[model samples]
Target chain A: MNDTPHIQLKGVKKRFGSKLVLDGVDLTIRRGESVVIIGGSGTGKSVTLKCVLGILRADEGSIHVAGEDVTRASGSKRDAYLRKFGMLFQGGALFDSLSIWENVAFGLIQGRGLPRKQARETAIEKLAMVGLSADIANLSPAELSGGMQKRVGLARAIAANPEILFFDEPTTGLDPIMADVINKLIASTVRDLGVTAVSITHDMVSARRISSRIAMLYKGRIIWDGPTDSIDNSGNPYVDQFIRGSAEGPIRMEVRS
Target chain B: MSANENILSSNWNIFAAIGRVVLAFLAGTGRLAVFAGIAISHIVRPPIYWQLVLHQMLRIGYFSLPVVGLTAFFTGAVLCLQIYIGGNRYGAEAFVPQIVVLGITRELGPVIAGLMMAGRVSAAIAAEIGTMRVTEQIDALTTLATNPFKYLVVPRIVAAVVTLPILVAVADSIGVFGGYIVGTRSLGFNGAVYINNTMNFVTAGDVRSGLIKASVFGFIIALMGCYSGFHSKGGAQGVGAATTQAVVSASILILAANYLMTSFFFSE
Candidate 1:
């Protein structure tokens, strides 16, 4: 409800060897704002998310969440800070060794220190919310189909009811129908939770379905940012080229034979 | 004019090659040592996963029994045969049982079992963890408020250290029995005398030394496996490389550690 920035990245820079991934990335998201970052395959959209999460430290500048500098926290303070976030990795990233219910309940039991029985109950409830039945709870993650695994990943991410949620390519590697289904679930989940949501995805349809605002990351900087509905008339050539899905534009594709 | 320069450059190239190789080896060693230190620091921390430790013990120790038993048996049989042939030259064939028991307990039992585990348990560990790494399961753990080192690494190290000594103890018995079988059945010696000679010649000190070495070898095997898996990158190929590295490094460390421990125990 508060209109202050919940997360802010000021001149954040990240470099992997000589390849500069995020070059002076500056972005701000207000509390409870659902923002989707879109870019080409290697434009460092994921790097920006990771920087805010403090998974990958920014080489230059600072990242602050809820007015607290991310890098300043350590030990239990850092742990407490991380507890506020729930992430859905692009790969689903479920623990293969654990049962599906256990995977869903992982953050609850491990992060929040919820008892296993309580966590399992929460896990089953969350799975049902994602339209998965409770019987599949005992099955291994590998047993589930790709779409089912993504649902399970969503269930796991929201099971802890984190204050902030991150979806990394939520609909990637799915059939169009399954991707649409996942988009609906993610849309409802974000609205229901009322959490600040940050997503990295190239799927414009999914982005439009889930995000309140859209930001285009190009060559490491946010070249365009506006309301989700206003993306079409943004006037930025890169944004126009990206939305139109055209190859013949300023954004050159390096085609390697 | 350029011939002298070419020869000098070639000479410099040889030294550079050696320097690079040596530096790579040192860097690898340093990384393993740092990983071991981090693992050790977690051991004293709270939230020790005893169930995971028990599970690893079953995997690393119980499942390795068959291969270790078979290897120990063959090794002891060969030792008896070789000792008999060598002793015959010096007219000391009667001492075969004593030397066989001594050798099995003090040297071969721990080293052989350690090598077997290096191939079996170490490779399995690296493959499993390396796959987890590539899949983001490890990063997922970080997000879920679990320490990967505490949850994944410490249990394995503990399981190995606790279980390996027990395995070597089993190996020593099977190995000595193997020597007994060959000495009495094939080498034309009385069974009772063979058992008596083995029991009289082998001391508690000999078995103790082997057990200590087994514990050290266990530490090395688990450390190498965990180290390789934790740092693995890429995908399936990375996991494969990690598995190979784990086995090779664990095997080499086991042998090197065996020699060092043997000398330390017996140097006086």
Candidate 2:
């Protein structure tokens, strides 16, 4: 395998007014690698992902996708860059107006100009990949359970066969069993497609299962990064505290009585 | 602090507050202008969604028939009655048909239909798009490599600009019919004379002007709706605010544009 990084972010910074969200972050993911960013609820994990997608522009530094500077790409260049990405938002974010299959086929039809019939076939194929059947294709997204919706979201994410897939808190609202199912699906999809995957989640089980490598974000930067097998013995107090889910640690979460 | 200093500081504070509001308004106007420019630019680009445009036309134009029709009809009836009653004092009651037709075609028909559509269409557009925004569906479109403006705003704008004129034509005719019903039935005039007087007195310019105003009103209504919804944040409360703002802003703009267009059209 040629060892070029599929994505690289160096000294990336983002802020909303006076709130410093992403403070000089740096990370890299090699092609075909599945990397999960583990972080607490307000640690700018999503902001980092958004900056890479150009949904939210970074205030400083650089982001490169396949050796092309994407941080400042605008208009057609930005659109072309975005075409390579498929994001599964936290809430599924399925187009509620469209049926399940239509939602899956959306990027294919709208973005790629595929024929409706071919797009429908591709949608069904993707849905099947996530363990959903063809019977549910015509139903609206609201008709699905949380787990099923996540499956549908996964199907949609992989619909266009994007080279890079992003999952924003893929397992946040699911039951443990459902979260595990989604984690497996994500893992299988990434492996089967041989695509680069970056996911943000607070779920440790999901992180360990879906990712080849894991990075823990704290204080607007990646505090720990290593192979998933080494996470337990990484000896970083913050990562240890987070994975252990103990209240007593160097990290103090705000709580009010 | 001394009383003089206190008074001076208080005066400065008041001016500062007023200045802030003025600046905010100007800033908002500038943002709206830029958004409008972006929307217009996307409108001329290729890959137009004709099906979506037709869908919007059905929703905004075709479905609005009943409300716009009834409003125009009633306004014409009332104008006929009022003009006749008021004109009777000056022995000018015979001028009812001419005046009612003039009023309906030149002003009442388009304005009433525009305001009614603003109330109906603007709120619907804002609520739908605002919900989409809150749910991150618009963001999803961007990630999917689809331009939300091209998919959402352009179709609605074009549909409104096209449909509003057709709707105004229907309203103008119904309004004229309403005036005829009142003029001949209750006012006790020969139907033929009423029709002939209206036909002779009403110029094509009057109808054309009203249609022009309706098209402009349509553009305003859809643009405000799309703009407000596109910027909505937070959640249900935010969508609610956007809906209300769309209606209010569209209605005001329609009236203001009416004034401006009427002045330019009839300046001579």
Candidate 3:
């Protein structure tokens, strides 16, 4: 892994009208490092990811990928820059109108303009990497089970062999066994591809399994960031409360009638 | 405050909520315009999604042919019946073919077909994309280094703009044929005269104008659907609302734009 960071964000601030989502956030992920962000719902973890992807523009801040300032980049330069990253959305986000292989090859065929036959072969290979069979590639996403869908999503994410990968709540809706399987797949794939990964998840087990380092987000800022081994001993009360899944801690759930 | 004052305050609150909705809607429109501009800039750039565009054209345009064809045909038939009844009162029954041909070619065919497409295609686009939004698929698209506008919006818009005129042209011709069928079979008119009158009286400009309207309406319909869908919120309720709003907004805009185009084309 390179000593230089692959993805970096500094003084990143974003707000939706009066509601501040990410407040002057700053973070960095080293090349080939797998970092998982842990946070409660609506704590701006997803917002942070969106800001980095340029899906939601930051109100103020700088986002850099591979040392290039992406904050002001536009058109083809930005698009070309984006080709380095891959993402697995929380819901798998597969197009229902497309078959599994087609979804996997969507970027390869559409974004990269690879021929259909070549893209399909590449898609099948990626699907196989994610433990999905070639037969499954012909089916629609709606036909797959939740776990299978996530696997297909993973396949799609890695289709182009991007240098950076982002997984948002990868294990949110899966059963424990399925979540563990996904976690292991993510870990092995990250290692095999030597790709830098940034993931956001509420599942402590998932965070523990897939990350080289973990960051806990609270009140729109990262309260704790360190190696995965140091997470349990970080002595941060917020991290403690979150990892323990305790109700009676520094984090309070909002209750409404 | 009295009871009447309380009622007035509640009404004011409603207005305030409405104002918020309006502001949000305007903001969404601005964002969509920006998104569209960005997508257009991406069109000629590398990493183009030609396959996706082709697939979308097949889906949005080719798949829409049957519906557009049927709508134009029925509209033409009904128009003929109405003109025949109205013209007969003044002993102008012979004018039915010309009137039907002109109306279908100049106004009714494109507008009505556009409205139908707005309801079908716009709602479908909105629902499909709105569901994707609620599910975080659009964000995923971004992470995949895929421009959602190119992957989602551009193709639909391109397909609609390219195909709707063709559909309108087909509808226009089929509609005129429908009038012929009705004028000859049901209305007891001279078939040859009706066909000749339709061919002669309906100038090429009228047909061209309707096709132009179709192209514009296609853009409006697809854009509204994509814009609403891309900005949907509140999960399922939001998706439903986006779909409804897309259809309604597309329909209204089609009519309004049609009036503007008509005035532009035929103004003295």
Ranking by lDDT: 2, 1, 3
Q: For model 2, how does the per-residue alpha-carbon lDDT over A89-123 read when each residue is reduced to its tens digit?
A: 88899999899999999999999899999999999
Per-residue CA lDDT of model 1 for A1-257, tens digit only, reads 37557888889889997999998888899988899999999999988887777677789988888888885565577778888888999999999999999999988877777899989999999999999999999999999999999999988888888888999999999999999999999888888888999999998889999999999999899999899999998999999889888998999987897
CA-RMSD of model 3: 3.0
**What is candidate 3's TM-score for chain A?**
0.98
Docking class of 1: medium
Off by over 4 Å in 1: A1-4, B2-20
Ranking by TM-score: 2, 1, 3
RMSD of each: 1.9, 1.7, 3.0
- Quality of model 1 by C-alpha lDDT: 0.91
Q: lDDT values of the candidates? A: 0.91, 0.93, 0.88
Instruction: Indicate which candidate wins on TM-score.
Output: 2
Candidate with top lDDT is: 2
**Cα displacement (Å) at residue B199, model 3:** 2.3
